[model samples]
Each structure stands twice: as C-alpha cells, then as structure tokens.
Target: MDKQNSRFRWVVFFSVLFTYLLMSSQRTAPGLITEQVMKDFDVTATTIGLLTSMQFFVYTSLQIPMGILADRFGPNFFLIIGAIVTGVGTIIYSLGTHEFVLFFARILTGIGDATIWVNLVLILGQWFKVKEFVRLIGFAGMTGSLGFLLATVPFSAWIDLLGWRAAFFSAGIALCLTGILLYIVLVKKPRQLFHNESVPVKDEIQPQNVRMLLKRIVSNRQAWALFFCHFGVVGVYVGFISSWAVPMG
Candidate 1:
C-alpha cells in the first residue's frame, strides 16, 4: 500500500509537470513564429507589436479574475477548459490571414494562458502541504523554465522545418489531448477521490469567497510586493523573449 501510494504521488507529479510544459509551449508559440505571423498577415512592426502586446495585455489583465474563477470552480476544471480554449485559439491563429483574425486569436490565447499559473498553483496546494509550497512552486517554476528553454531554440527550428501553422496545429492537438488526460486522471481534492482519506472539513479549508480573498490579498503589503516582483521579472523577460524572433526573421 505504501509503495502504491508513493507511485501515485509520482504519477501526479509527472502528470502536472507534463501539463505545465504543454501550457508553456502553447504560450510561447507566438514568439517562435513571429516572423511567420508578420509575413502571413503582411503587417508592419507597429501592428505586430500591438498584436504581441495584446497577448500580454489580455493575459496580465485577466489573471486576477481567472484566479477567482479557479478558486470557486476547482483548478482541474479551469485547467481543462483553459487548455481547450487555448487549443481553439491555436487553431484560429493557424487559420488567420488578416490582422483582425490574428488579433482575435491572440486574445483567445491570452485568456487561455491566464488560467495556467493560478490553476497549477491551486493544484499543487491540494497535493502538497503549506510548508512545502515554496519548494514545490520552485520545482514547478523550473519545469516551466525548461519548457521555455525548449521553446526558444528547438521550437524555432521546428517552426523553420514544419512551417508555423503546422507547428501551431500540432501543439494545439497535443495540448487538447493532454488536457483531456489530466481531467480524467487528476482529482482536485484527494479525499473526494479517495473515500478512505480523511479530508479536512469545509470551514477548516480556506474560504473560497472571491471578494473576501481578493480584499485580503490586496490589503496585504507582502502580497502586493510579491505581485509586482513577479510582474516585473516575468514581464520584462517575456516581452523581450517574445519579440526576439521577430527582428531575426
């Protein structure tokens, strides 16, 4: 039984890691194929800039709301839905030939990407104890970083060989399939899935009330500091990296 339990934990870890990598790949696809995007759309630098900005703009703006939704409806559901949406967006992006269609595609992708980090954190929290949160989060971060690393060089090569649209379509299919698999395999609450386990009562768990939680998060100085820290670091890195291929192409 102990060995089985240990195996189950490993399964959960790898499953989550694979899902995260898929999500990261989808998010970084645009960066890898920005040149193709410009050629296909026949757009100028300014337009491409706007479109790229739209990805981050929508994602950053919607994150708070996405987090709220993830809390109220379990991360598993949100993660699955987000992956589906992202897949659809990728399809749309592949089909787009015009600026408007591309804009819409980016928007959809942004919305889909917004749910990723929050949902991942939510899922991790359920599996790991609070004391282990930072370490687990760091591990997840490393996995995501590995995904990004792969996206930068190898994904670019794939774009060159496969053509951008084909690559996007392939990635979309992979993400959709992974999302379906995760939905089937993952349980948001262990107790809910394993009846023998003693689950904490509702009141014992943190409140799921969105407004109250937001109020607390917003009021906390440390939270704001952390938010800005994340924003600054991720924002600058993503911005530069997303635009790198554009000029090269």
Candidate 2:
C-alpha cells in the first residue's frame, strides 16, 4: 500500500469504529434507564420488554438482506444510511411522548443498527490484509464492549445530569454528524484509495448469484451450527444485558 492509501485506511478504521461504538451504545442505553422510562410513560415492565424486543426483532430479521445489499452496493452506502437512520430514529425516540411513537422509533433504530455488522466486516476485508483482519476484528469487538461501558456508567451519569432525553438527543446528533463524516471520508473499497487496478471490485449482483450464495450458506452444516450457537449465546446475552441486568441491579 502507498503511504497515502495506508494513512487513509486508518481514518476509515476509526470512522467505522466510531459508528460501531455509537451503535453499541444505542443498543444498551435503554437498559440503564428502564425504570425512569417506565415511570414517565406509565408503562409496565412487559411494555418495556416490547420496546427492546421491537428493536431486536427488526435487527435480526434484516441481517441476511443487509448482507446482500452491502455485497451489492458496497458497505459504505449502507453505513451512511445506517448512521443517519439511527440518528434520526434516536432523535425521534428522545422526543417521543407516546408509546406508539417510541415503538416506531425503536423499529427505525433497529433498521439502522442492522446495517453495521455485515458492512463493518466487509469494509475490513476491503482495507486490511487477511492476517490483520483477525486482530482488527478482535479490536472492533473490544470497542463494542467499550460502548457497553459508555452506555452504562457514563450514560447513567448523563441521565442524572441531563436527563435521558437530552442525553439521547446529544447521541443522535453525534451519530448524524458521524454520517456526514462517513460520507466525506469513506470509500467503497481500496481501489478508490490506492488507484490499484489489481484490487478486486464487486461485480453487479445477479439474482442467480444471490440464490447460489444463499443456497450454499444454507446447506453448510457448520454454518448452521455457528448460527445457532451465536443465536443462542449472543442473543440471550444481549437480551439480558440490554434489558434486564441494569434494572435488576
């Protein structure tokens, strides 16, 4: 990689990392403020569960479609859309005064949140060598954990000081700004940055290709095993962490 291309890749890394951090924070922030939200909305715990569930439902349902779209259009396209949608959704949620509106907001947020993981992986593959990808992905996971931390202690403090609405409103604005930054700095692939003709670019996706990809993935027993494992472990862990843990504490 040329020095200019090399330096730009780190910028891409940090920008996308920030996007993931904000995504993680949004996922977990509601957990810590459950009681307050319940009181304000005159809602029961089950109602609050639905709020979290709405987000999760939309998020999980869209994963394969998001992956296909990211493959088709490039990760940066969806990243921009995701960031802005998340920001707007959060803003609406922050300003919401009714149950229906809140649910709608979560749904929007979920759609935006759905875009991150697949695209993040794709972008990493585009920018980094295979050896570096593993370490970078590990670091990305750690950054997500840091987002959980931000959503906990510091978020709690923000709620105490600024109120949850203001706290989330600020976060929404930050995400919107992040979207703009992504638009300015993010390229579809390294080809754009390095002017390297040898770098592979995505071809236009075809219906048959999509079907083949799906069919192959679906037929992979090992893939199914991994899917179930992730679904069971991460699903339960995220559910508990973002819904019950803080409230129970």
Candidate 3:
C-alpha cells in the first residue's frame, strides 16, 4: 500500500468496525426489545423465541455460501451488499406489523449480518500481515463488544425516548450510511501491503477454490476439534445473548 492507500486501510478498518458496531446492535436488539416485541406483537415466549432464532438460523446457515460468495466476487461485494440488505431489513423490521413479516425481516437481517464477519476476515487478510491478523481481529472483537455495551443502557434509553420503531428506524438509516462508507473506503482485493511486498504472486480468489477450502477445513483434525469447542461455546453463548438475555432482564 502506498501512503494514500495505507491511510485508507485504517479508513477501511474503521468502516468495517462501524459496520460491526451496528451488526452487534442488530444481533442484540431483539434481546433488548423483548418486552416491547412481546407487547406489540401480542405474542408469547415461543413466538419471540422463533423470531429471535430466525436471525441466527439464517446467519449460521449462510456462512459457507457467503464465504464462497466473498471469495468469488470479492469481499467488497459482500461488505457493500451486506450493509445495504441489513439496513433495509432493519427498516422493515421496525415497520413490520405481522409476525410473519417480522420473522422474514429478522431472517433477512441475518443474511446480511452473515456476510459481515467472514468478509472482515478476508479484508484483514488482504490488508494486514498474517502475524498481524489475530491482533486486528482482537481489536475488531473489542470494537464489536462496544456495540453490545451500547445495546444495553444507551440503546434502552433510545427505545425509552423514541420507542422501538423510531429507534430501530434510525439505526437502519445509520446502517445504510455505513454501507455507503464501506463502498467508498473498502478496496476490492487490495494489494497486501501490510505483508512483504516481495511475496510471490498468487492465484486469484475464485469459486472453484471454495470446494478445496472446505475440503481442507473438513480434513483437518484440529479444525474439527476447534469446531466442537466453538460450537459449544460460541453457539450457546450467542444464542443466549441474542435471544434470552433481555427477557431475563
């Protein structure tokens, strides 16, 4: 990366960082709005459970396909589309009347959110050195956690003042703007400047490679071991935080 592009890498990082902030809000928003959702939708725990689960269901299911799309079309494609779809879905969620519509909105939001984390991983790979990747991810995790923190009291205050619809509506608009920021700042398959410039050239990212990637991942014993651990920890943890935590509150 030249000086201009080097500066823009941080810009790209922050853009994705901000996108993660809103993505966290979307993930945790249902928890915060449990009571409001229950009252407004006039539904019981089961409906709310299903509604909340809808997002995660789509989110989890789309990971492979999303990963393939990101690699094939470029991470920028997913990043841009993800933000746009998420924003639109959030707006729909805020405006939704019926349970079914809300369900689809949540699912759509999940699809959009699904594109994000993986795309960020790809972006980190494109911009930073391999050794720096983990640290950048750690920082990204911290930034995302900030959104979770905001989703608590500050978000509650927004709902208290504006009501859930207006609050979510505003967030949706912000998400859309974030998408535009991504379009402006994020370069598609940017040259790996954070790494050794003399590193050998590599094949282009392509759709066919996705199959090999999956095969490699599945064949790795350590990957399976870590998969089980992540499944038990992250899956349960996210499910609870994204769904049950607010109602518990």
TM-score of each: 0.85, 0.88, 0.86
Prediction 1 global C-alpha lDDT: 0.75
How far does residue 49 in candidate 3 sit from its true spot (Å)? 0.6
| TM-score, prediction 2 | 0.88
User: So what's the TM-score on candidate 1?
Assistant: 0.85
Q: Per-residue lDDT tens digits of candidate 3, residues 1-249?
A: 442247656767778888998987888786888877888889998998888889988988999888777777788888888998999999999999999889989988998999888999888777666667778899988877787777877888888889999999999999999888787677433444444444345635534666787899999999999899879986787667766676333
For candidate 1, lDDT tens digit of each residue in 86-145? 778878888887889988988888888787889888877776667667787898889888
Candidate order by decreasing TM-score: 2, 3, 1
Comparing 1 with 2 on lDDT, the higher-scoring candidate is: 2
lDDT of every model, 2 decimals: 0.75, 0.85, 0.81
230 Cα displacement, candidate 3 (Å): 2.9
Task: Provide the RMSD of all predictions against the true structure, rounded to 1 decimal.
Answer: 3.2, 3.0, 3.8
Q: How does model 3 fare in lDDT? A: 0.81
The CA lDDT at 50 in model 2 is 91
